[model samples]
Target: MHDAVIGGGRSPLQPRALVARSWSRVLEAGLDPDGRHPRDPLPMDQVLARRRESPVALVIEELRAIISSVADASQFLMVVTDADGIILWREGAARVRGRADSLGFEEGAEWTEEVVGTNAIGTALAEASPVQLFSAEHFEAEQHPWYCTAAPIHDPRTGELLGIVDVSGPAMTLHPAIVALVETAVRLAESQLWRHHELRLERLRAVAAPVLASVTGPLLLVDDHGWVAHTAGIAAQARIAVPRDRRPLTVPGLGLCLPEPLGDGWLVRPAGGETRIVMTLDLTGPPAVAVSGERPWRAPLTARHAEILLLLHRAGRSGLSAAALSSRLYGDAEHVVAVRAEVSRLRRTLGGVVESQPYRISPAVEMAVLGAPAG
Candidate 1:
């Protein structure tokens, strides 16, 4: 593979190792190189809906200015896709857009290797790396006229593969630096995404501070999928398995307990022991929770408020920054105003329990989960 030649000559007739591999995979999948069109293009409405809900939507929005700045005078088109290669957004020169539309390269088109043969979008995702394909490097005869560079974008928090961002234009427009340009854009998008997550975490930390201020024992805060967001008193060696479904299970160290629904996740505490304090998170209707200890109290929480609390609890004493909380809450860290306003309301509701300045819960409190054994 190292010895394989990359694009250089006037015509990109030579297949790089990665492109050659993609060609092989395409052939094995039984796609015809002469196929006139790709398969399973989503409807425009569906594509718009997906874009609205996609995690990368905000990133793409933020990149609009950068995209225009970098590609305004060029024929290159900017494309964003979901991990599966469904194009969610495409923007560029009108002439180039028309050409791309003729080739079924519009939004909602699926460009997976199995569907579209060897192309930059599918190949980059398949190889999990940045890729540039030019002219004859593409397996499909029709795609040979196009040159494209693409790079996969990943979740900043979980490192999960989110999708790919690509730049495409006529083969004659190919530049050696296009690959680097696409890579830079992907990095900027990822950085923006990270900032958003940090903001959301910060908001959560603010809400959890009050709840945490009331706890005084080993505790763990986990999201709906059981990913630990925060912890206290529990040793690092303790591995707790949180069930995906709402079922009771015996966790190591914690004993038999069912996860109680809190915010967007579950608050797991021991079922039986010298239980001195109790917190009941009622998610049945309008979100509400009750904390009982020396200071018995209950508060009605809005859905957003509940989510903030859960994230804060998960963050534990390390706390969360505004950027982190904003990302987690709204998928965009730039929504700092929303986070601040929400935190303000939360403080008013919970009183002096929640604190600011790198938001975190008070150490004087300990949160423990308690649930009845699943039937």
Candidate 2:
């Protein structure tokens, strides 16, 4: 047992450094190497209830056909687990399913590292990345005959870990390419989740359009979690993280403000004003714009918004018309409405610093590039 636990030489099939560290943790938990690790299965009714409530339920259902095809060809057991590492769903060839069942790999079984040693499902969840474990690499002696590859799936909206998708089979069936296959499947699942959010955003946009037409000042429509679903006077960046609480929140470029409950999320309005607002644009990374002086605030800009702002800043006294800006932004003069919408959102964040008609920055506001000297 000691020799198996602390081998001197590294085998070609040995676990990666991260997996090895996980194995150490499993041992520290005092799980017996030879003894049968107790199975902690949730009640069948409870498991069914939990699966129904899971956000990934539809995603997993849609991927079933693809997962079935892979399982049939590779003789691998396909398993999906919740974030807690409890098996929520399982599908595979009859023989593989039978073999896995004998080892307590059925639905409702807990496979967290502390509960079941360092297997692919648990380790992938722990590391929040794709992983593969072959034969002896599995910390448990009983699991030594199996090879497994798994990838962590994340909630597209919140970027939170949702669950894991794993493919496991006999060690002799190990194929190095299985890791990539599992990762690809995970990506498809995440994309499906993203589409779900997009659909919800579209519905929210419809509801907001009418409300926005009434408001004269800048306003935005966000989801229940503070993610921007659509905007009227605010730049519709990919997302805006607003505080979940009702406390006064500080917005970048727009000083301290209180969020008023509107539709699914809150409508933010600036509480104070700034005399001299200096805006900094950093084009290298995510392209963020920071407003500095007295009460400082900053916000990230989408690629399109960043380009429009840069063009306007360079225009100086000669502002660009909607048609000219449309051609520059979308390569078509017909997209004037789209150009106007973007400018309106930009104005909301920049306050009176950004002007329309001929889109241009306000004379009082100073614009600076991070790597370049302040102008």
Candidate 3:
């Protein structure tokens, strides 16, 4: 990793206009826009201190491990920065540690675009690209001695920025491989972020079921493209009659469907009680954005509410009866009445948003209720 940082890769071909524009932006902003130090200013003590307050430190540590394995160079230092430019993680040679530390290049120091002007980490974040800064190209005199390469890290599904991965070393040793190495690290981090999102959403889906039992009908989990990810037992059985692979399951033609693509998944039901109860769900492409847990829906919850939500998730959103809900909670009709009262109070609190209609839970309520149970 160190070697790659020092003598790693060729920089991207610079477009004359772009280079001029970038330089113009720098010159127009002048040397100090924020009135802070012109040099990179993160320190090791601060970076270490930030671990408690920031999650990016852990992410950067993983990036360091990845870069070290693929690039394997000593002079090369791998660092992770937040959206604001604070260095969250840095792993490199002891010789350069002083310089890095002096710049507040450690975890807690802020390295946002505002602080460092148009440097690799800041610029890459602004442009959302892989950037290389060698020697004289650095905006600040204090940053002149190092060659730096950085790539933006984005969450795959939502394409939202997570942070950046940067490698820096002595100017003379800058190489072409640095860009590739940084890109590789960024991609790995993105993959990890996406997987984590999916698992979290799935857990929410499982938890929301019972709470929503009184809302409406079957609870269904569909992908962004309309494929089914999961379904309550009732929905599964109802859908079993319909061909699962039939493309583009249209609601009016076959059954009712939610119009919105919620991250917690769609809450839905058959428009008619006599309808086959069968619905088609698409799970064919990349996991749906709704399944990634990026957008969470709020559900009205109480202790009894939570119990009912579980039953709804396990059963269907047919709106469990007081007896059924009570059985789940206290295994007796009297207790069930008490729980039912709680549900009634919760219903009023959630308003029409809870969607109690047609003698059951509404599809929208089911979508939110069956997806994320109250903590």
Candidate 4:
């Protein structure tokens, strides 16, 4: 079917829409169907570095137990990759692992579609959705003998993609239940990660309790990632931009402020002498955002987040709900999860300037737009 539809351009047994979409993308990338299966994997040192840095690293042993336990070890191999599709951890059937080694499916191999054509790991990353490919469904002829199921693992709190968990083996070993197994593993991993995050926050809260009671005036206690652990004297937002030394942070209602290092988090308070600040969202060129205060700063915005700001600005004081933002941004409201995630990341990046629970620009920020695209 892959050859008939992808090469001959037509087939009575039409490919599944997802598979067809992947074939089209692989073709566009100009990969040869007969290309060699093996490519040079990253050095061991680099692989270790990525493993240490990935959030998925926290749940490696749990994933091993969940996925490998459900399968006949010799019939399946489990692999984990970071958000960029670089394999970080791989284990399971030693026999199947040998097959994977021959195909360069070992750790540190970058399995993104652009590099290896349409396979489970790369396709899941491209579609931002779980994927399964069997036999001839693979874009690469060399991969035609393999079957794989993959699902994206996400950070539960912010909806950020953390990595992918995939199971693969010879086509003869493909199990219909493998996809479900991967999905379950993904859920477990994310929940474990979230639990870890919550525990850290709780510990920080404990450490912060006494310090906050003694402080006067408004302040916020946030972790390194700006997650609010505690607040006092101020009407607090859940998060703010990541705190860094020597850089000024602008908080809604709190005015411009400097973040001081607390035990394991930050203590944020007004940098004194405050006045109303005018912030600008410039849609001109590459999405530029600037804060106009005594200690002014600018943050770079991705085009998507830029559109988000433009929409919020247009929505005025009424603000737009996640469903509304989903419809406006994606032409449908089914993407509420994705919409919320984008908005969460935006709120964290821009801090208090963008308020939530019906997203809108903070009243404290007098926002003006320049060269915004007209609908």
- Point to the candidate with the largest TM-score: 4
Q: Write the per-residue lDDT of candidate 3 for residues 1-375, one digit (tens) a residue.
A: 111212333445443443344554665656442234644455657656655555454355567577755443547677777666777767777766667777556655655455665578877876777888776565555677788898887757646576778888878767777777788777777777667656755765676556445555455555432335566545342221111221112232235332333455454444343322122111233212111122233332445454454455445556666676667678676775476456655444332222222124335332333234334
Estimate the lDDT of model 1.
0.72
Once fitted onto the true fold, the runs of candidate 3 whose alpha carbons sit more than 4 angstroms away are 1-17, 32-61, 69-73, 202-216, 220-375
Clashing pairs in 2: 233-345, 234-345, 235-345, 252-297, 252-298, 253-297
Looking at candidate 3, what is the lDDT of residue 29? 58
Each candidate's lDDT (Cα)? 0.72, 0.76, 0.54, 0.85
Segments of candidate 1 deviating more than 4 angstroms: 1-14, 236-246, 249-253, 273-375
TM-score of each: 0.64, 0.64, 0.51, 0.76
Measured by TM-score, how close is model 2 to the native structure?
0.64
lDDT of 2 at 265: 61
Ranking according to TM-score, highest score first = 4, 1, 2, 3
Better candidate number, 3 or 4, judged by lDDT: 4
Which digits, one per residue and each the tens of the lDDT, describe model 4 over residues 1-375?
Answer: 677777766677998899989888988988888887456789999999998899898889899889877556548888999999999988778877887787888898999998999999999999999999998998888888899999999989888889999999999988778888899999989889989988888998898888887889988889999888887777867777778654456776577777888888898988776544578888777898887665677888999999999999999999999999999999999999899788877766776567778788776668888997777
Off by over 4 Å in 4: 70-74, 274-375
Estimate candidate 3's alpha-carbon lDDT, on a 0 to 1 scale.
Answer: 0.54
lDDT head-to-head 1 vs 3, winner: 1
Per residue, candidate 1 scores C-alpha lDDT tens digits across 1-375 of 212322222443545678768877877898776677546688889998998878998788766766746665788899989988999989988889999988899889999888888888999889999888878788778888899989899987767789989899989988887877887888899999988766654555565667767877666666543555567776543234444333333444555444566565456666444233345555566777676643466778898887776777678888888788999898989998789778867755653234466665444334442331222
Worst 10-residue lDDT window for candidate 3 reads 239-248
* 1-375 per-residue lDDT for model 2 (tens digits): 333444444444545688678878887898766668988788999889879978889798766766767787788988999899999999988898999988999899999888988899999888888888888778778998999889898998667788889999999998877877888888888999999888877787776677667766665566765667755555556554444333334444444555667666666656546444567888867887887665567778787788888888888867899999999888899999899878866655544456666777765567887643234
